[model samples]
Target: MRMVFRWYGEGNDTVTLRQIKQIPGVEGIVWALHDVPAGEEWPMDKIAAYKELADTYGLHLEVVESVNVHEDIKLGLPTRERYIDNYKKTIEKLASVGVKVVCYNFMPVFDWVRTDMHKELADGSTALFLEKAKIEAMDPRELVRAIAGNPDFTMPGWEPERLARLSELFDAYREVTEDDLRDNLRYFLEQIIPTAERCGIRMAIHPDDPPYSVFGLPRVVKHAADLRAILGFADSTANGITLCSGSLGVRQGNDIPAMAREFAGRIPFAHLRNVRVYENGDFIETSHRAEDGTVDMCGIVQALHETGFGGYARPDHGRHIWEEQCRPGYGLYDRALGIMYLWGIWDSLGRGKQTKREAFSV
Candidate 1:
């Protein structure tokens, strides 16, 4: 596994490249232009600016976290063709920059849903939490307010324009069953996978956050079977999944390590992290360490190592560790800790020569 860190551009992220370089085993950054709205062509100049920054630190810009799919595409609106054209152009632009993997998601309005952002954990650190029971009973207006209340950070799934009419969005999606969603995704991949393959970039689709249907909206990429079905839609290496443990592991019965081994041939990228699941379907993000969280980080890493996961991997969401007043889950302290934990496991597998500490020393 080639280790990477997620840096939200220059001024966008509180974590700096200098600080990211301090993390052991990290050789690159999982980056993107967060300000660029979905379906718009990514400017080559903007991509190059980040490339120069990474070059300065001797790091590669090999993976991008997301190139968000527009809602029109998912809804199968009349304007979808236009958006898909834009997405194809964006893919071409990204490929020109030598980016090997593009991680994107197809979930509706909210990419991922969390009941509370500051849910306190046993380790005295706070993290994103999902109380399943509460979500089931939540009113749409209240849900909108909870999501919008946090003006300090822009929530990935809850875009301002979409959230403005939650009811309309929800109503429009009521007819979009699982099968319809899958068909739409298939249509999308049929059009774009060829470009991705030609450009030598693998398109890894992120699993729905929380891995379930929310607010009566259908979510197609919720489980392993869902991923399998979607991958089969376009039998190209370019069409792949961005296997995130925290997202897929939240649902009971998803063997995350097994996914790494079974989908090894197709998977080009992964997000490694853990979430502690509780009774009544509730779960909270935890340290990426295996022992601390529900997911088996060690076994998963070993599986990837055994499968020869040559694609990019990065530490996913992290807790608010050590009084770091940073973005709720994007704090440097816990994610740095996560990178060390991941490296320790990957190193123990015997393929690695240098310890993370030594490897990180530029």
Candidate 2:
């Protein structure tokens, strides 16, 4: 498992590349041109510029968190073809700069939903939390306001430009169903997989945040079966899944460790974070330690190690710690701590495997 950090470019992020370089075992950054809107082609010069920045920090630019799919592509609108062409061009541009995997999602209007960005935990450190009951009762507009309430920074998934037209987007998805979303995703894969294969880039789709339909919006990439179906859309290795633990772990019965082993070769990217699930179906992101959250993070890492995973992995959302004020979930302190935890598991597993081989040799 190659460790990477998620850095939102130069001025946009509070965490600097210098700080990221200090984190042990982190070799790369999962990044994107956040300023560019979906469906727009990324500028080639700008892509080269990003590479230059990473080079200065001695970090590899091997993975991109997202190249968001246009709503037209997800809704299967007639204009989708034009947007697809734009996507193909972007893929080629990214490939030109040595990007191996491109991580994206097909979730409609909202990407990840949370009731509170700084929900205080028992330990006094705050983290992103989701209360299903609150979502079911509150209006999406109110939810958007709450999520975007941190006016100082821009949330990756809940972009104000997109959420500003929430009512229209909701009306558009009203007639769309789960089956429709699946078909559209298949169509999207079919169009882009060929280009990705030729460019030597893997297209990994992130599972729906929470792994369930929100406010009647259809979610297709939720479970193991859904992952198999998505992989079946294109037989090539280029089509794949991101296999995010926190997103899929929100719901019970995901069997994250098993899924990690099952989809071994196909997963080119992973978002490793933990979320504690309550008996009442609520969840809150927590430390990456296995005991901290419901997700068995150590087991998941061991599975990846056994599979010989040679892909980019990053510590996903982390709690607000040490009073370090930054993006809601993208703070530095906790994520660096999470990296150390993952490394501990990985190195111990490696040593154990070596011991077994050495014992047999003697």
Candidate 3:
């Protein structure tokens, strides 16, 4: 696996490229033009600048965390074709600068939901938390206000412009059932996957955060069957999935290791993190250690190794530790720790495989 780190950009992120360069085994940065809104073409100059900055740090800009899909495309509105064309252009631009994979999601209204951005853990550090009962009881508008209230950094999905018309968006999506959402996603993939293939960029859809519907919004990319169906929508290597352990692990039934093995060939990107699931359908992001969370970090890495995965991977959200006072989940300290833990497992597994091959050869 090729280790990558997510860097917001020059001024947007507290973690500098210099710091990222110091992290062992990290060879690239998963990035995007965050200032640009969805359904718009990314400025080539901006993309080039990002590439230039990464090159300065001796890092590759190959995997982009997201170039968000327009809500029109997800809603199947008449304007969706225009947005899809814009996405194609963006893909072409990114591919020109050597981007290999683009990670995005089709969750309507919200990309990822969390009841608390800094819910204190037993260890005194705070982590992103999802309280099912709180979510069910709170009005989505209020929830949006609460999530967007973070003064330190702007949350990706809770953009002010998007949340400003929350009621209208909810009303627009009221009739969009799960099946309808699936059809819309298929249409989107059919339109863009071919372009992605031509540009030598893989379009990897991130599974809906939490792997379930929230605030009555329809979510299509939440299960293994859902992932399989989407891959069937376009029978090309460009069509792929970004297997996120924390997101899919929230469901408990999603065998993350099995996904690493099953979708081995199609997966071009992965978000490796763990989550501690509670009995009441709630969860909190945890450390990368196997015992610290529910997911099998070792088995997942081993499965990727067995598949000979050469794709990009990164440590996802991390807890607030060492009084870092950074972004809610994107802090540098904990994620740096996560990288070491992941490298430990991945390197050990790789060494074991090499030893076996040498034994066979002898």
In terms of lDDT, the best-performing candidate is 2
Candidate 1 similarity to native, TM-score: 0.95
How high is the CA lDDT of each candidate model?
0.86, 0.91, 0.91
Candidate 2 minimal-lDDT segment of 10 residues: 353-362
lDDT of 1 at 255: 93
Candidate numbers, best lDDT first, in rank order: 2, 3, 1
lDDT of 2 by residue, 1-362 (tens): 88899999988899999999888878899899898898899999999999999999889999998898989999999999999999999999999999999999999999889988899999999999999898988899999878787778878987777888899999999999999999999999999999999999999999999899889899998999999999999998899899899999988899888998999899999999999999988899999988989998988999998999988889999999999999999999999999999988988888835432221211
Model 1: how far residue 267 lies from native, Å = 1.2
Runs with alpha carbons beyond 4 Å of true place in candidate 1: 351-362
TM match of model 2 to true structure: 0.96
Estimate the TM-score for candidate 3. 0.96
**Where is model 2 more than 4 Å wrong at Cα?**
352-362
- Number of the candidate with higher lDDT, 1 or 2: 2
* TM of each candidate vs. truth: 0.95, 0.96, 0.96
- Candidate 1 — worst ten consecutive residues by lDDT sum? 353-362
